[model samples]
Target: MPVRKLLSGLIGGMTPAGRFRHACRLLERADHSVRGFARLGQMAGSGMVAAQYQVACAYLDGIGVPRSPLEGMRWMHRAASAGHVEACFSLALMLLVDPPGQDGADSLLPTAWPEGIDAWPDPVAATHWAGQAARAGLPDAQALYGYLLATGPESVRDPEAAGIWCARAAQAGCPQGDLALAVNHLCAPDQPPGSNPGAVAALLRAAESGLPTAQYMLGLLHERGWGLSPDAAEAEKWYARAAAGGVRPAQARYGVMLLRNGRGNSRAIMAAETWLRRAALAGDREAAALLGDLHACGKAALPGDHEAVTWYRMAAEHDHAVACRMLALLYIQGRGVASDPDQARDWLQRAAVLGDVAAMTDLAATLLDRRDTPPATPAQAAAPLPDFRAMAQAGDPVAAFNLAVSLHRGVGCAADPAQAAMWMERAAEAGVVNAQYWYGRMLLAGEGISASPSQARHWLERAASHGLPEACIAAAQARLEGYGGPRDHAGALAFYHRAAEAGRGEAMFSLGAMYGGGHDVPPDRTQALHWFTRGAQAGNALAQFMLGRYLAQGLAGPVDRAQARHWLAQAVAGGVTAASAELDGMMLADDHAAP
Candidate 1:
């Protein structure tokens, strides 16, 4: 009962189905022999559906034949037309992965088509064949069909149908079906996305089934508390798994989380460095920038300076705005590189063009400072001014303040106090600290606006709350003098102390005067002497004069004329004319006492 003899004797008498069966047995027995392929090819040519499908697989996979996608698709199309389920599904998968008309698509995909078939791979045709196999009870086909319907082009998309097919495939134990359904649930536009326990469960199932993408998505859900409570440990676990599986984004996320939680842990920091380096090498721009930051700051066990420059340059070339600015700073400061102003300016311009506000401000300020071109006329003194006006109009608060200064000083434009006040107020409203202080001063002096002590006090106090030393002194003066409202000695004292703590010599002198003169409370000679000594050491002439007098009169601690003469001479050098007369009188008294 040799199959060759049986086929030779009964081939003409047997039906097409019987011929296909005999051909399959002959091929199995021949084991890739030339005769076996010839026989299979002959049966496939005779319109046998099963024989055609087998031939298609043989050509596609190069089993006992030279691989030919054209021949494979031709045979596959023939079998599919004859109602071969597997052949239909196979062709659909090929088309889905290498769609027609896409430039540089998979070269192995069918390029030439036989007559009467479509000339190119088409998603619509793929979907049709996938649907055919799905209805034929192929679980993988059902999952693919659902994915196509749910995520394909608008003309072919049908989410309702996709959901049904995905559910069917999932019930049949398809991990891809679960993944597709999970993504649909998590990304549904009409629903509150990412709050579904069912979606989380589906993703977990897919992730456990060894899908790297599913692991990454599950980690994101856990990190953000979508559909569950936020769990950093759980998120890190899944991200680590996905990262180990070669998921680039997962590697970056895992590294960032490790860094955030690893403050003093050397082992965790080292692990973070390893993962972030991998992600950076894989072309993850954020990961590269983050690595640059860690290296620049000497964190994550990375060698600083040179390593920071390398990472930052890589990210900057890829248009990372912050990285570009950081690299520019390194170049400007000559850290890990020779100082190059031109390179710094070029990088700064790149960062500014990429919408980095800090870079824009820095670049503008640098340009203003390095104006090598002399002004052609007094009216155009700041003619080549940096584009602060443009940046300010773009709502940059710092730029607005710079423009206000230019307008007030007639630097790059005509002096317009009214315009300056308007821009200054705008900058102050946007919370620019310097603008707030200047605007308050302007209001107090009526230089650019009406003198309004009440408004000045309000603005100065606002600036003082933000820790501006000059504003604190001004606010204290206003409070003590009752310039805008009722005098509040306690408030004035608090403001003066704040300014003095910030090392404002004027505030120190004011404090000494207030305590010595007993302006609001009983005079404390000891406190007066202490404040005067401190203010004098801080180079306040009035404070030096007062300290000299206090020593001469034995008011605070002692009558030390030697200390008095020393302080009075110091005050005379500091432009206190009264100290010279006091020193002269002391010398005269000393001369008479010597006799």
Candidate 2:
């Protein structure tokens, strides 16, 4: 392990031309046995970790070797054991695929390394490898490792460890690690105060000190407050600095931000898009991911083009989790592309493999929905459906909620209300607003746990804190009804106001009615009319009808017969029967006077 001998070992490894020839030869031997890689896998000390990874991949995936996942796995570990960074990444990925303990063997996970392998699933697997590689100076691995250590659950991740790696990487002139590390820490709510400020300072310092990746990250941070206070001005400043450094990503990001926020020196929206396209071609995942989204969503800014899926597919090919989710969603929804349920499942599986919770939830939902769409038989339902509970246990909020629902109601599985309560509790604690609502309901009713109204109120308050408009409305309703809690009209109005601000049409209309009727809050005809008008403009049909009534009856606002008729027409169009009946009666009266 001495530096001189290690360097000598590396120098004595394959020559540049020899490594190239070896890689090329791998193409011609695509059908060879993976076991042969053990003999051919020897890389000179000069062979970089990435190059060794290519060899490990060939052995594990049958890319250029005979199909033998076991041999491939063994070879990958050998390289990993030798402290190769990419090999460590592959090993970590394998571990995630086959979580070490208590994961049922049937989970289709990677077989744990057999006896004789020197390495095991170390808690800091990803970081350990990255640290070694980073210390020797590898930018991508440093950034990746720092990010993993900073954000992954404590079951695997470590912020202090992440900080150490980030500092080393930053000192060694790897700017991307600084920005990515900042984001990693920023994503964790439990971090000590000033964690983000310190991380952002490091990123800014690195960016200003001339690391292109840092500059790009600083631009993003200032753009979205990724780990720092959002300041559009500062974003543009860092972006300009990065652009001056010839970072294609910075130019594209800066252009896009200008276009999005309508700031100074605007790139023609299309021009900005063109810069993103350029960055995408240059292999920027962020650019490719953004372009894919733009193409998929087609706005006045980025026209909806199925071709965006193509770009997304390309980016996803390189293991971009967001791109993977995007592609899976498209395939599942059949949007701007042929619908392929199977392909959607495949992409979702891949995305989940890359640790995408959204993809995992969608996949579980797809299976559940597919069963409903096609109507699986009772026997089929009895059979173990895909273990979506794994995803919930793994920290997918939606999945956690759905898992609770399934257990509570016995959908495609047996009913287990007690278990359902446990899952719901987890989802609620994790901040799924709907789950919070349900968990509160369960607590209030003692569905599984013992009755605890105080706990129920706590959960409801948390849901309200998240501004789930529906939950706020429901909680307000509960409070007003004095169900499991004391009545507080003032508090109810506060929640209704929150729901109204969040654009709950029903809540908005109700707020208007309460104001008009002097219920909940003091009656203010003017405020009622204003609220009704605002709600109607926001396309709330009920509000439209109520506002029309106010005008026609001269209740809350000055009568405007013509405006009343117009809003009445709108309400009728929305299938408001009372409005239709009123209009019919009015027209009949008008006809009676027509002569």
Candidate 3:
């Protein structure tokens, strides 16, 4: 039997109350017919607010009547105008509700309206209806009215008025009202310190009512010791509760705390991973990047490069700069994927565009290499380059260094050594060790800057202390030549040894010259020959020339004409002017000795 018929038959000959009850029962049925609801609506009379509200709900949701929000809202407006409290509140809620796909505070106000309608869910209409409901003592309406007053259309944002309504709603047991009151007291920059007590009380009330955002805020307060003693344990407990309630930021914080402080507890580690994954899936980019790092580094029980790549890609697609840079490195090293320089460069470019300083530096180096040897694809050739001056001004040290290099070398830019020196100095001050060495060299050479031997040595020593081999060698030469300070052969020899140990070919050659000339210590022909051989093998053309001449004349050891010719030829290929003359002399000698 149809629900409407059954309900009508059962209620036949009953009292008026019974008829109304039966009508409501019929409307409540999931399969109730639209025509039957329309008949019941007529019988209930225009003055019956409950019946009108039910019919409006049915129309709005398409429960029995045809889905017509416009008609539903009209009926609701009629009931509300007749002083039905719930009808007023419901109308306000429908008007103020956010459109789908947006969530929480970021949700956009509804804009849809029925065909031929001028406006529906209008902010002004919502505020008017909400005000009526609030005046009727509805806590939810009071809270909503307060929020709308503070954050509605530009003309309606009255903070003082919002505070009054919010206080009334909170006193009447509205959780949202309590939250608003707490935020007003805590977050308003103009609020006095006296408001902290009220903010904490309001937050406590909301948290006790099981509001997740309130719990998260309380956790932050406890963790930061804001108006309370710092308590990590209490903070973690609140964070855990918030995370369980599906708060994304709370989930991330709780997961990170657990992972950092788990102390090898497998249960804590597992729980942390679960919460982090939940947060990551909920579109928390930082959580996704953290998960990627954990998996990449085999932490929190996640130990797979492929899994790391998946997480990094998720964050990277969301425009996470660090995650993109990490993905680039992984691709370049073939750690979790095939080594593809193109893919690596692509990811690096993405990260650089997202303002990753390290990525910008790496991308610049790659572009410079590509300039020397053209890239295979036009896309690679046309990849957008970062504005070095802009990035440098934005405090990227590597960008300052790169800009300096471009200016100094006139690579795609006008040569301006003065500007280059200025940029190099900026990079050096910003802690680029290589830039410090270069700036020191510029100072020593008076290259677009006044020569200051003392300043040159100062910067060189600083860079050397930071383990820059080239800076160490330069500092050693400065000491040996007494260019900046008093000559100290012993100090120079010590620096030379340090640089040589760090594989500086120039330092090795200097060591050989010191021993061969007996300038620093007593001459040692054996040590000189050993140092020259090592420097030559390390590609020092001057060392190769010296070694070849020494070997040919038997200066350090037994003469070996074959080795001398070989070293001289290698030195000539290395662009040593004296090596070329020596090789020619050997060729002439060979010709003279020929039969």
Best by TM-score: 3
Angstrom error of the Cα, residue 227, model 3: value is 2.6
Cα lDDT of candidate 3 equals 0.80
Residue-level lDDT tens digits of model 3 in 1-595:
9998997687687876666677777777776565548656875465677777777777677777766666677677777777788888887787676432345432333345444223654787788888898998999888888878877887777788888998999999899888777766664568642247876888888888999998988888888887667888988999999998889999999998898789868888888889999999999989999989887766747567677888899999999999998887666544456445688789998998999988888677557646677777887778666568887888888788888887887766898999999999999998777689889999999997999999999899887764456777889889998988988787788788767765667888899998897586778878889888999998998889889998999998899999999999888888898888888898899899999
Count backbone clashes in candidate 2: 8
The number of residue pairs in model 1 that clash at the backbone is: 0
Clashing pairs for model 3 are: none
- Flag regions of model 1 displaced more than 4 Å: 1-83, 96-126, 281-283, 304-354, 362-595
Cα-lDDT of candidate 1: 0.82
Q: Candidate 3: worst 10 consecutive residues by lDDT? A: 100-109
Which consecutive 10 residues in model 2 have the weakest lDDT in total? 99-108
Per-residue lDDT over 1-595 for candidate 2, one digit per residue giving the tens place of the 0 to 100 score: 8999996586459786565565546554745434335434554234455445666677555564555555556666667777786676666656444333334533333455544443444445655565566655676567667777877647757777777776666666666666666666556678743356777787677677687767777777777766567888888878867866778878778657756765323245666676677777777877788788767655426455466777789889989987998887666544456456778877887888899877777666556656556534575455455566877877877788878878877777899989999999998888666689789888888998887877887788777754556567777877777766787777887887777765667777877887887565688888788888878887788899998888888896567877888888899988888988877776777689897
For each candidate in turn, the TM-score is 0.53, 0.41, 0.56
lDDT of each: 0.82, 0.70, 0.80
Whichever of 1 and 3 has more TM-score, that candidate is 3
